[model samples]
Target: MASSVLPTPLLKDELDIVIPTIRNLDFLEMWRPFFQPYHLIIIQDGDPSKKINVPEGFDYELYNRNDINRILGPKASCISFKDSACRCFGFMVSKKKYIYTIDDDCFVAKDPSGKEINALQQHIKNLLSPSTPYFFNTLYDPYAEGADFVRGYPFSLREGAPTAVSHGLWLNIPDYDAPTQLVKPMERNTRYVDAVLTIPKGTLFPMCGMNLAFDRELIGPAMYFGLMGDGQPIGRYDDMWAGWCTKVICDHLGLGVKTGLPYIWHSKASNPFVNLKKEYKGIFWQEDLIPFFQAVSLPKDCTTVQKCYIELSKQFKEKFGKVDDYFNKLGDAMVTWIEAWDELNPSAAAALPNGPAK
Candidate 1:
């Protein structure tokens, strides 16, 4: 690792980096120093008795799962899929101008050539710098073929080739599903150009939670990570499913989704069998669920995100009325999640800035 110090955030007191973890704060001990002058919210999901060590002068807050369940009440309990599901808790509680969601195992990539480039600093810079209303990561797939699009690349834009997607390069480990690895192994030591590719109006892609940043205003509408995680109906797909819903909601509101830049080094290894087993439920439901998102009815002149979600809940109830209750729970959770956001982030409500330009 390069001996680079954490860079001061441009947003200062206005940014909150939300991470969900069930482990100790060892990663923070090593990298928290880099995210100075910003608030860090750690969602300690399990073993709440084990205290997290917070070094002096670090602006941070730690919340256990029980604490969040108490705060959000029973309606929000179904949303807690696993440790990563804690992201929704962080989202509702966040009162900052921007919310950055990253995994505990993820870290900034060192410049492969041993130069003095800090990827985390670049991510913060890119995130803060005015570009689009939303950004979907366009990082290179280590397992992708020449000119091949990533797995969730929209079929709508596949033929027409839009340019709003940005490409990010990761150094060490890559974030891919287990099945992808079984087909072909990830190559080591790869660098990619940081290009922001434009996404057409109807395009959608699988958004990764490991490294995602979004404007705080979208929190109410976009913070719907549904029933997933260990011991739940499914383990993975909470973030990706939420991403699809968010992209649809964003499109309805005329929000731009940009993909690319500020590459991250994922320090974890892929386990195909375990991941494949966990992915079964989500994969089975996605084929039907995604089409529903694309075709769902929404008022063209939708005034508020809340109204849009009302239609969404109704649609969800209508579509999946019998198969299972996940959709209904999701629908109810969406409304409650917004309410929780309003209740928890009253100051944010007071700051009521106008939505970003469509």
Candidate 2:
């Protein structure tokens, strides 16, 4: 291991992180390793006044969502609890030139080689060089294409392709949607360049709110717009909404959205419902499926999809016998995935490259 060097005080241009957490102290402890080197703002949604044990040398600001809303007005939108914490935190702290938000459950992978980080920095500089303003989106897997579908998108592997964009990686959102149409077979893998990629109007990506970075100037004003009059958040899909807002803003500004370079690994807790079939109802019944069920509003006509959900729910209950049993099974699966990931991608398994303090 390298000698521990204290991260230099934050620079105006470096990425600062904001994390929203609830009652998972264990999860916070696991996240400590990645929090080093960045300004860490933790929003304790469950209890605002609760004091957390943070590692020395790390800067932390704790806030309760409830208190924020009461003090800031309904526009604070810290109401939905978990998701709201993210929204509120994004709105409040984020003082650096650039801001990066990651989920509390996520662990940062080791920092990429200096060359790769430089490449990412250059990519951002080039994207924002145009006369017009622009918004950038973070890349992630299982890319969401809005509210309708959640999966089935190609992943870019070529490192230098300028036109290629990796999911959950990095993107600039324009303020307004462009009249320009998406060119088919969206080009993949090339050196970084300025370009516009299109999705159907109103399309939202399954965003990994776990790891997103953006220019403070571009995202700051937009965050205010997302709040309800009462300070409640209007969109359940903050990342997706932010992405869409960026597109709209850029198109109107004559700037274009570009996707490219450097991949970000999302270390947040897994959503087991992602790929499970209803026939696997046994899985859902045993585990808590309320959130998954609510998050995914699949069409009824999609019988195959419906069946997959039903079966998974049934099997989950049958196999687990109790919800506790289901949780155990889920925990086992997560552990297995983590172990497998460590074996397969040793480099990505390290602390988050740029994340909140411990």
Candidate 3:
């Protein structure tokens, strides 16, 4: 077992890790060695009949759905059955400077130097590095061939101006669109890549739920993964939609999306058949949704990104009224989430140059 691999001592107190899982806690023991300095929040997703058993002396909280609902209140119901939605629960309760969402099956990849490197530490280093105005960049993978952009990266922004959102990529089992799996899936032990990309300004890329982290300061607006996956009406696309919403709002706020670096080895592989089924609706809807999001017109008075997000959802409902009832609930949930976040982080809300519209 290795100790903390944080590049800076300060990160010890600044980062918290969240893992949402339907599986038991046995796999978590592997993480105990490096987690001493950070807090871990384990969200038990399904069949919470048995309690998750965390190793003794670990600073952690194991919460089942009921516990999360209690913390999130009535609006929690809006989140529904999506596992990705659990991230909102983690984000709201996170007390650190940064919050990391790592799937239970994901692990930090070791560097060529044979030293264990923590992905969260690497990402923070990249994120905090002095950049002009704002950061919207992709971390490039050193091991990958050619110019392989992260899937769902917005082509429109490839040449657009620079702007403060960053998204990382995964190795081993890559997180690609379902169509990529039609041929074959990556082997469990596929070689991973390294390197961080500071995506050029004006780039809009989707954020991955697994192995992703963001600053708590932006929590009020970007900390949402809506109703799209984990057995909800839609089988997949929860994080993708959230990413799109985040990018849309980020663009309005002059923020950039950075990808690459802090890579993780995805131990679990999606069954291609299951993935194809899960992604069918999402793949079909995303083409139209992107342009729709681009065309959405926020109110002139819309100040905060959260307000813009609510407006975006409302617009989505109007245009796609017959899409699905859950879509409307997603809008309702975002409204509820923004209100709850404002109440909880009044200081952060006040600090926002454009506070939520009253």
Candidate 4:
């Protein structure tokens, strides 16, 4: 790690760095070069009695399990107790326009050039730059320096949609499913792809929350990580559930989602046997869940993020309730999530100033 470094300019103060963790955040030491300058919203999951400490000097607001129960009151039931899903609590409490969330185990990754990758800065650029979701750009990110739309690209769609989410990737330990992790314990991801592809509208992607950034204003309310972990039957799919819901909402609202680029060094892999127990149900459940998200069509009246999300919750109740009792509870949790979101972030700060053009 560098002795001292500068934070990403202009948006530094306006953006909040959200991290969800149960253990002491010694990982931030590696990120201090890029993150120390910003405000951190640390969502301390599990055992509030156990104090989680951050490195000295970084400005942060730490909310523990007890704090969450107190703050959201009845609505706190929507937040998962001993899971990363509780991280969304940081999202709810945040007043900033941009949110960059990374797991405590993820470290800074270096690009092929051997230079330390500034994942935070790249996410900022992704959020600020336009996303061409309507049409795939052959040359990848047309807005990236030295890149442009191919010859046959449509002029009408060139401006593209406002990117609501920037989904990043990981290097070293990959985010594989439990079965895969168990089978390939020795496998590691050394391939670093430089392109950032906009998830074309109407398509779904498995979103890993380990390293992610989103424009909170454009799609904040829809960014709930769903009800998983602790008392719930599901686990690990917290980010996946949020991604599916958010993607549908973003598509209906004419927003965009991009993935790849700004990779992080995933330093640790969770125990596969433990992960297997948590993921067993979701592995099968997602078979039905995928089609539901694919078929979802938000009504024209459901324009705002909250409206879209509430409407999505209704769909969850109507469609998945019959699938299992857990779906029904998840549906209820979804509604509660919206209620808590609205109650906490009362005034919608939707208008966020864009970063300078590339």
- Show how many residue pairs clash in every candidate, following the order shown: 16, 72, 22, 0
Query: What would the TM-scores of all predictions be?
Result: 0.79, 0.45, 0.80, 0.95
Best by TM-score: 4
Can you write out model 1's per-residue Cα lDDT over 299-332, one digit (the tens) per residue? 6654455556667777877887677776676667
Residue runs of model 1 more than 4 Å from their true location after superposition: 1-8, 54-57, 116-121, 124-169, 185-189, 346-358
Query: Native-vs-model 3 lDDT?
Result: 0.65
What is the C-alpha local distance difference test score of each model? 0.63, 0.37, 0.65, 0.89
Estimate, for each residue in 203-234, the C-alpha lDDT of model 4 and write its tens digit: 99999999999999888888889888887888
Name the candidate that leads on lDDT: 4
Off by over 4 Å in 3: 1-8, 131-164, 186-194, 200-202, 229-231, 297-300, 354-358
Each model's RMSD to truth, in Å? 7.1, 18.6, 6.3, 3.8
For candidate 2, report its TM-score.
Answer: 0.45
Candidate 1's TM-score reads: 0.79
Model 3 lDDT-worst window of ten: 130-139
lDDT of 2 at 215: 50
lDDT of each residue in 166-278, candidate 2, tens digit only:
12343222111111112222323223332323222223343334444455433233332122212321223345434443333323222233333233333332232321221
From the highest lDDT down, the ranking of the candidates is 4, 3, 1, 2
Which candidate do you rate higher for TM-score, 1 or 3? 3
